[model samples]
Target: MTDRRGVVAKRAEDLMPGVPYVRGWNRARQSASALADQLVLLGLDSDFPGLVADVNVVGDGLVQLGTVRPEAAELLATLIAAGLRAELHGTTAETPATARREAPAA
Candidate 1:
């Protein structure tokens, strides 16, 4: 049987799924900061703390969406997807400072 620590570790691994490649708009370097803030507001900060980062794609693309850690890729992708869908439904982004004010106190 696995130990308690092992079980918890395994669960964390399972909960952290794989990330998808999110491209299209919002890839511009200038947009990276806003993207990261969106991720944080969407509750992705628990998984990726730093913020949305601007990464260079190997091929021709205006922008790229990926995680520094393989595990975080999935959550990041989900966040982006949700954001896109929201925009499609006429959603507007909340400002970084505004989001911070609304975040649950630690």
Candidate 2:
């Protein structure tokens, strides 16, 4: 179990580039829990229903959307459609401040 968590942690870290955007999304209107709910709903409605089972809201509103999965791109697209400002892992350097500024008001 510990080893699995460590692997998951590493995967989360690899997915960290999207954190700032998710945090900013939370700050703009929704809460981390709300975002998690959205993720679950989206997962359930999508082809990869189990792709997002372990969504966690970590320190300072960072949303960890579990480890990598085969539907990563689709998940990112779903999140963006749901108003999350995200990019493919390394494609974004957007900070929380920037995303907050860009986020639409709730």
The TM-score, computed over Cα atoms with residue i paired to residue i, of candidate 2 is 0.28
Candidate 2 weakest lDDT stretch, 10 residues: 53-62
Report the C-alpha lDDT of model 2 over 22-78, residue by residue, as the tens digit. Answer: 554445234535655655554432433333322222313233344445455444554
Q: lDDT (0-100) at residue 99 of candidate 2?
A: 38
Tell me the tens digit of each residue's lDDT in model 1 across 56-92: 2221113334435664664445445655877998986
Off by over 4 Å in 1: 1-29, 49-67, 82-106
**Model 1 residue pairs with clashes:** 18-74, 19-73, 19-74, 36-52
All-Cα superposition RMSD per candidate: 12.9, 14.2
Best by lDDT: 1
Ten residues in a row with the worst lDDT in model 1? 8-17
